[model samples]
Target: MASWQQIEDDNPTFAAKVRSLFDAGTNKTIATLRRDGSPRISGTELKFEAGEITFGSMSGSMKLLDIRRDPRVAIHSPTLEPPADHPEQWPGDAKLAGTAIEMPRPEGDPHEGAGYFRVDVSEVSVTYVGNPADHLVIESWDARHGYRRRTRK
Candidate 1:
């Protein structure tokens, strides 16, 4: 697992691309594990702050309960439909998988009672069609595998 800053320090270019995709829109999706081990998908907003990826849930929210019970989560970046006339111009989508750890409340936080957490990232990936739009490309980094690139027709 790695901190957001560690990933950026290790691979600035890849981090920047992933950040662009994430910043393309608001309201990303997060997947958490339920008590039954099923996946629960919920809307969320995350921020890159203090060298970490952080998010919060309203007090007593189910998402917070889920994380308190089990911190594993996956976050998907906001996405847009590809341009009908120019598929080659489509921006990629990004994903992050990690463990979310509860953090001490930050001073002067507006959501006074909300639960805040930071991710210890295990994997990150971005997928898109490459230049010329010939094939799909996936750039990925993982704690175990380091970094890799793959393409598909």
Candidate 2:
């Protein structure tokens, strides 16, 4: 797992693109595991701040309860459809799989009773249409394999 700062330090350009995609959308999606190990997808507000990818859930929320029990999680930035006329120009979407460790409440938090967590990223990635609209491209990074790319026609 890597910290947000480590990712930025390793590849500034890649990090910038990831951050831009996340900023392009308002509500991202988070997947949490239920007690039975089932997956639950929830709409969430996410941010890249204080050198971490972070989010919070309101007190007594299912997500908060889920995180407390199991920290593993995956987050996907909101998506945007590519323009049919210029499909290759789509900026793509950002995603990460990580463990969300609970953090102490920050001073002056508006969501006073919310649970805050900072993700320790296991993998980070993005997907977009290749130029010429020939195929889909995935760019990814992980602890085991620093960076890699794959394409599908």
Candidate 3:
């Protein structure tokens, strides 16, 4: 796994595109694993600051409990469709998969009693339809393999 800062340092361009997708909206979708190993999706607000990607949940929330029990998570960037007249203008979709590291909430944090987690990214990817040729373009990054790009019809 890699820290958000490390990803930024190693792959600035890819990181910027991913960041743009994440910043395009306020809320993102997060998937967690329940005790029964079932998948649970939840709405969340993520913050990129201090060289870290962080989020918090209300105390005793199911998502909070889920993370405490199993830190694995996958987050999807908000979806934004292109204007009807300009289908090629879309910014594309991004996904981040990683393990969450629980951190102690700061003393003055409003959600001090809640749960806070910083992501240790295992994978980051973005997919979009390329213009002109209209082929699917996929870019991915990982701690083990670094960055890669692929295209499909």
Q: Model 2, which residues run further than 4 Å from truth?
A: 110-112
**What is the C-alpha lDDT profile of model 1 across 46-149, one tens digit per residue?**
99877899998899888998999999999999977878777778888999999999998889887876898999999999998777788999999988887789
lDDT of each: 0.91, 0.91, 0.92
lDDT of 2 by residue, 1-153 (tens): 999989888888888988999898789999999999999999999889877888889998999999999999999988999989999999999899999999999898777778998999999999999998999999988989988889989
CA-only RMSD, every prediction: 1.3, 1.2, 1.2
Quote model 3's TM-score: 0.95
Query: On TM-score, who's better, 2 or 3?
Result: 2
Worst window of 10 by summed lDDT in candidate 2: 105-114
Instruction: Supply candidate 2's per-residue lDDT for 61.
Output: 95
| Alpha-carbon TM-score of each model against the true structure | 0.94, 0.95, 0.95
